[model samples]
Target chain A: MSVLDEVLSANEAYAASFDKGGLALPPARGFAILTCMDARLDPAKYAGLSEGDAHVIRNAGGRASDDAIRSLVISYKLLGTSEWFVIHHTDCGMEFFTDEVITGLLANSLETAALGDDGFYDVGTGPGSDHGQHIDWLTISDQTQAVVDDVVRIKEHPLVPPRIPVHGFLYDVRTGRLIEVPVPSDESAA
Target chain B: MSVLDEVLSANEAYAASFDKGGLALPPARGFAILTCMDARLDPAKYAGLSEGDAHVIRNAGGRASDDAIRSLVISYKLLGTSEWFVIHHTDCGMEFFTDEVITGLLANSLETAALGDDGFYDVGTGPGSDHGQHIDWLTISDQTQAVVDDVVRIKEHPLVPPRIPVHGFLYDVRTGRLIEVPVPSDESAA
Candidate 1:
């Protein structure tokens, strides 16, 4: 069966046993979390959030990029979220490659797919041409630094309320332990 | 207790019983899901995804913007994920406001916070100033159309392999039903 089919079947079971239906519009905990899209970091399970607790905004590296800021603005301005948690995990896939390497792979894939030869379907090859120009992969060389940078970005954002505390964290994929990264306290912040 | 404290306490409890420890780097299901950051949409329960099943990339409206594309490229090129599921939900918060409305609220909040008066904190107000310039907000007037547009964006991305299937779906928040949205088939895609 296809993966979609499996999920659909699972959804059927979930619907049948669904009980948590009346959650409020805004997050119950008055916070939003920005984290990596790693399957291992189950926000609800690891973060101890039940249904309707918090808004979990996830991307590849969990970098507080422009997209993350946009979401945070909505989370605070409209959805009543006050706190921001920027969590980047240890041993992230993003740490493994640079922007150029990834874009090169993509370019190669496109070129090979155009050729339409099944034999040429090799995911791994020698260094590919640099197609990742100007794309900040946001690849994590240092996990703690990445998280701290994101926290600062949130704290400094004009749209993000100065009252909202932005916390940075690092989750170890192997041990499943969450370590709090210390960010410089913004004295000027409300 | 603060929400973070509550969650940290929960995380401790979760770690005590955590058993899904050693899942691999890549998703086992070879797929990734793009969806909203709504608390109600528990991907594991509703989509039948377990730990290490799929990379769930979430944001405000689940729009396939540049950041989403960056993540998708990583998921496909670095990770083994092959399929893409763009799932937008019913009763999304995005449908409630435009970019201007949200940005205006933010501006008002910043102004109020600057005033340093707790009594001035009012969430209910009409017609906020335009604080959301250059921010797409990815606001959804129509949920289905938004999903379709995101799916198309993913399909048309240069980095995304044309061979990979991009499916769009609408998830009902109240009833927990997953409805598939029809996307035009790309006959040229592998």
Candidate 2:
């Protein structure tokens, strides 16, 4: 069976015992989490969120990209969330390659790249686009710094309110732990 | 306790028993899922995903915004995901308002809005920005259509490989079921 079929069948079991249908549109916990799309980091599990608990915005590196900020803005401005967390994880795929490297790979071909001991190398032939060159890819060199940068970016965004406290953390995929990344005291104070 | 403190406490328990430290960086399931930031939808639970199972990109409405496409591109181009799913859920907060309404609310005040019988209304005083006016917000008028649109957008993206199949599904928030949103046969065939 396809992964889609498998998940659909799983959903059947999930729905069989589903009872939390009346959750309010607004997050009951009054918070939002911005994190990576990495499959290993389950925001609901790590963050202890139940249905109707919080909004979770995720992307490549969980960076504070414009789209992510837009989601955060809506999460608070419209959905009544008062707090936010920006989480990036250890062993994140984003940290494995830079924008130039990924773009170079994409420019070669749109097929999957193989990761050897050294790093990723393209395996496909022909039919590639330079479109990836235009994207930042939000690659991460430092996990803690990436989390801090995202937190600061979200905290400093024009659309984000000063009242909301944004926290930064790194989730350890191995141990399933969230380690806080401290923003500068002055920055947090300001 | 603050939500942060509470979640951290919960994390201790999750970490204590965590034994999946050996999972690889790339998703083992060889697929990706783009879904909404809705608090009610647990993509892991609904999709039956374990650690390192699949890439899951999420945003306000799970709409295929450029950033989402960027993540999906990286998911396939770099990580080897062969299939993708665009899963938007029922009763999403994005369906509660239009782009204009959200930007209008943001323009009035950057504080949290209240949801009453009429819909969202700003209750905070002063200091708002028109920055939101520039954002797309990607609000949903119809859930199934949004899923179909996202799937089509991902499939037709310049960076996405044509060989990868993108599936569209609407997750019923009430039942925890994923109902397939059939793409027009020609669209999928193309």
Candidate 3:
């Protein structure tokens, strides 16, 4: 179903409120590195990347999107990514944002939480809840498997071939230390 | 192969650059959103979402990653996301940054050029050359479908579910419009 335009307009009005607080961030250069634009992420520090070194591609949690893949494909075929790094950090916002809120917002925006799952809104979920303070959060071990699986999947893509190496990493946003996930490396050994 | 320590250090410094930026970008509320942080692709304007809404994920192309999926699982079961959206946009930097820059930068620092499929980097091809400007460049239709496929893959996983709704969209950075890719509206329809 089409997203509610009125809801979007309202969101725009509110999000505009946020622009006043924004850092006026600029785009990265060279190869884009997909990452969380999260202030805590600090992909450069954690991933050991630098500006003008690699394009720091960021989103919510740094999930690879079709465009990311398309960029990756171009990077590999025309550019040079024989491998990739999947970095997901601890206490990520992606962990907390739920469908209920989205549905609720949509319902509230549309003035009737009556829509089913088909109504996917194309608006920002806002800055989301403040999740950076939970120092006691779990290490997110399953997150390791997620990174490994992505590497494997990306490697096996019909367009990418089977040999590409994808490394899985769990970065500690607070500490800036990267812990390698075992699945990809283990599977590569096998 | 492990990521370079210097790279990590540089990234740390870059992240630190934001210390004065002052915007306290909050963690995603429930699910991490993976959308382009492209200045033009405003989530509030397009996705009909807002602050405190959901995890406003961002990246170059909003591609799904293993880490992203892992986080999604946590969001769904632990946090509460029954839905997901993958948004990418036209005129993305992902299309321009070359692989040579990424690989070379990772291999060395910002100065050294990484070799390519043919070898000899300095002359054959330089770093950061994969991406460029397209006159009408931006917004390929398949960009949306790729995200849908990613969502479908995530939903079918034992970690996710088959009933969840997944959406794919391409944002026209110039016109401020969101176009629906030709993915099945409902999985049942497929």
Steric clash pairs (candidate 1)? none
Candidate 1 CAPRI assessment class: acceptable
- Sorting all predicted structures by lDDT, with the top scorer first, yields 2, 1, 3
Question: What is the clash count for each candidate, in the order shown?
Answer: 0, 0, 55
Candidate 2 chain B, run of 10 with poorest lDDT: B117-126
Question: For candidate 1, lDDT tens digit of each residue in A16-123?
Answer: 887776776678788889999987778888887776778988999998989988888777776678787899998787777666555656655543212114523244
Judged by DockQ cut-offs, the docking class of candidate 3 is incorrect
Ranking by TM-score: 2, 1, 3
What lDDT tens digits, residue by residue, belong to model 2 across residues A52-136? Answer: 8889999998989999998888888777899889888898888888888988888888788887776547446768888988888
DockQ of every candidate: 0.46, 0.83, 0.12
Q: How accurate is candidate 1 locally (lDDT)?
A: 0.76
Regions more than 4 Å wrong, model 2: none
Score chain A of each prediction against the true chain A by TM-score and list the results.
0.85, 0.95, 0.57
Q: Give the C-alpha miss distance for residue B28 in model 2, angstroms.
A: 0.7
lDDT winner between candidates 2 and 3? 2
Candidate 1: give its CA RMSD in angstroms. 5.3
Q: C-alpha displacement of A144 in model 2, angstroms?
A: 1.5
